[model samples]
Target chain A: MTEIATRDAYGKKLATLGEIYPEIVVLDADLSGSTKTEFFAKKFPQRFFNMGVAEQDLMGTAAGLAACGKTVFVSTFAIFATGRAWEPFRQSIAYPHLNVKICASHAGLSVGEDGASHQTVEDIAIIRAIPFVKVLVPSDGIETEQMVEFLAKDSGPCYLRLSRAKAPLVHEASYQFQIGRGHILKEGSTVCLFTAGFITSQVLAAALELSNQGVSTTVVNMSSIKPLDSKLVVAMAEKHQYLFSIEEHSIIGGLGSAIAETLVSSYPKKLVRLGINDEFGQSGSYQAVIDHYGLSTRGILESLKKELKL
Target chain B: MKKRSVAELEDLACELRILILKMVHHAQCGHTGGPLSCIDMLTALYFYEMNHDPENPHWENRDRFVLSAGHTAPALYACLIKAGYIPKDEMWGLRKLGSKLQGHPKLNVDWGIEMSTGSLGQGMSISNGMAMAARLDGKSYRVYSLESDGGAQEGMMWEGAMSAGYRHLDNRVALLDYNGIQIDGFVKDIKDVAPLDKKFEAFNWHTLVIDGHDMSAIVAALDEARLVKGKPTAIICKTIMGKGVSIFENKPKYHGVAPTDDEFKIAMQELGDQ
Candidate 1:
């Protein structure tokens, strides 16, 4: 099984797009190497702006460039990009609905060894509440590449969450990515497991384990969390007896809460949410953190079995 | 556009000041002091300095202006109306519900507002971006941003200052409305953002200090800004909190308050209005 980090894919895709879209400009706040915008900076130095540790300035500058008809993409750590510069993001970019792509890297507990200060578990909730801003969490490298290409051509504010750790490929190279859409990776009857970001790989492994135990399950990759595929969520709710949501972020405002909001409004179903239960992350290896948080394959399988009473 | 005489510019400033006072008084809410202090520069820019087409607000090659001290939107709205970007009838709708004239300037490109600004210290960074865009496209249009002494206290302002200076954004010109008053009290009494010119000079900007109400000085400083190369310029306009209106001048109480009916009559009278 091939593996690649979404941040790497973002850098490669942006460098490729820079060759095609002359209007595409990139800005980073002293984290180009970490966030992988350094690739574009190296290739297109004239178009890249190193804003230097000032997130507010980075966001406002991006808004200014976008207003002047430049397709601007800004990058930084999730905590600083969405937390430190939240007001500028809301007033300058999101309020005006500018064509700025905020592709923040090192999201969720996957940012291991950096501690809770670096991990942004509430970024999705904070960004999604802002009107006119689309939120996307691509499950794997292939989807991330396609999502970057899609956002480059699309206009308006978008927040794309990427992970630091690499994960197994969940989608084929020929997979077509669209904004506000989700994909079903597998089919089952008794239970449905919905996941996003790199955690989908674990959820897929859990589904395979459940099949061996004779518990039928379906796996749905809900990459687009903002303009959620409510139709597909409703269909899954109507078909499966139990629905489960898993993510590497806080359960409060991430994939779980998004699914709960849709199900409670349209199609009520028995659902279980699996994620960090309203707690901050600690410094540890990525796999150790996942195991401790019950996001590993074994932990997910055990949680599902307990929820399904099997 | 033909240049207006110093006396004519002063008269136009007085008229625009009256318009600002009336709009804020009718709305019953606005920053009275800063708008009054900054209106003269806005009038000069719109009426004389900038290369803009009010008939076509989104003209591609037009110069850009960002009001960093966005609480002064009343002044901007008055200038926009006087410059023909908006009609005089829309002045009544300032800060009203569903109005295009938001409390702070919203990005209504068709109305000639370049960027939505209200949060202090963010506008200069945006101005840098517009200047960089002009350089990228090899366009000759300039960018101007106006901020108050209170707004200069924000750290992001310094970040933008460093960036503009480092990048040598010669197309960008920033004006500081040095009114020395804020919502709480005098800027010196509160945070003390003094020696502003030296600070900007240290940041690699071509610095100028001028009497904000002097129309000739304002025009000359703007002219000097265009001649500057390899760096941005900062014009520190020393101004009273409320210029031209005697009752509100240098009054901190009027920083965020609207004029009462009696005060409005006094203000209009002071500005040589009915």
Candidate 2:
């Protein structure tokens, strides 16, 4: 329990938030333990509901709770939570801006052994395109905790993207994480690496490797992908001569595209983007898939080196 | 919590219908049939039954209304404007690009619209969540949702129904516009959702069968729904498609058809001095 998966962090934050707000309700699609909402379920059984394995109904039910002024967080894996239930989330939640937080686990390559089908590389893009949804991808365990608490009282609907794998705590316990603000992890001049979710550390590792090879990189833990932390991103891009964005998503509409959009509005730099090259992944081991798809930390370093002519 | 007089409620319903027609006609698109079927129920809730504030749509204690039969958005939109939840001018912009009035009910376009409902069966489950939430919070507000009988075939609607009943959300009220016709043909032929009352009963819901277009019957059924306890209530209001308009009434072809100018004119004349 000490070094918990980010999924369990969701339950802890939700239970804490629920104690404060009577209207807070938690829903799970039979993944209460997996998504860590089981904690809330046990503590506040009346306030928690298990909508079985039906993701679509689960989403609709959360929207219903939101309709009555209850701040509801629905738990499920990222792929089924967003993909299977996208329409209800579209009409009942996002379109209406219902105050339901879709707290999903097993996001990105962190889902590991479940393979590409369960890994949600496109969850951000799918929800970000929605009209009124706020997309939050936390960098690490502490940040994930902070985000769940923040979204609890937030005015509109939000999607809390989480990781299946355990990540080292990035921010200090007292460190505050703002929903739309980007956190500056490390600062340098030659290159700026913008990334989100679990990939924050992956890109950071790549940047560090590049640093040892005589390149100074500015790494931004871009947690709020929808808002893009435009001011910091633009400023970082302006200072760095080159920009590289990486994520555990499709290169087309993921964090990289969002960074490109922000940087385009201000500073224009020679940019390199990396992720799934617009293709669905296959079933494979977690480490094997990361290695095969060239998404591991070493992969990122190698790709950046090749792109920068290292 | 006092009820409005029959005459006032009837007048509100007519006014709402006229407003919906005018907006749909001006916007050059809107679903006309289900709105006609739902006006009475919407009027009963907004003007009489539900506890709500027009000024603050998101007021926590306000009674929630979800139009599960989302194509009937014009009816809900018209009632919201007429009741002062939003400005009346907003209706004219219905279905227009950049307008708050969307082709289907959506929240991003407008504040008063509760949830975006276009796909048929999603709303009832949402209402279940709302009602269940109210119960959990020990709140006085109730949730009301109306789904089309055509929408009844969807697996999720029944899922929500069974769950709402299982949870005993007695404060939740669901109305069905049992007008029979779907897009391709009658529900009996396309997909029979008959035995709906028994289905709900088996789901542990207190059920009521009423004439959908009858003001007295609709209002009385809602009152009875309020008194029921230990289980949710669903009123199966039998109605005719395009109610009150002779030209298109009960016609399946008019399900998604935007009436032509000629059809609109005849329909307007048939509605008679609204």
Candidate with top lDDT is 1
User: Candidate 2: deviation at residue A102, Å?
Assistant: 1.6
> What is the per-residue lDDT of model 1 for residues A70-163, given as tens digits with 9 covering 90 to 100?
9999999999999999999999999988999999999998789888999888999889889988999999999999999999999999999999
Span of 10 residues, lowest total lDDT, candidate 2 chain A: A1-10
- List lDDT for all candidates, in order: 0.92, 0.82
At residue A249, candidate 1 shows an lDDT of 84
**Every candidate's CA RMSD:** 1.1, 3.2
Q: Candidate 2: where are CA atoms >4 Å away?
A: A1-4, B1-23, B46-62, B77-93, B96-102, B106-115, B258-265
Fraction of true interface contacts that also occur in model 1: 0.84
Residue A75, model 1: Cα distance from true site in angstroms? 0.8
What shift in Å separates residue B256 of candidate 1 from its native position after superposition?
Answer: 1.1
Write down the lDDT that model 2 would get.
0.82
Weakest 10 consecutive residues of candidate 2 chain B by summed lDDT: B106-115
| Model 2 agreement with the true structure over B1-274: per-residue lDDT tens digits | 3478768898888777777777777877667777877788888888888887777777777888888898988888888887777787787788888987788877632356777788999988988887887777778888889888889999889888888888888989999999998888899998899899999999999999998878888889888988998999999999888777787789887777677888878877877753
Please count the clashing residue pairs in each candidate, in the order shown: 0, 4
Query: What TM-score do all the candidates reach, one by one?
Result: 0.98, 0.89
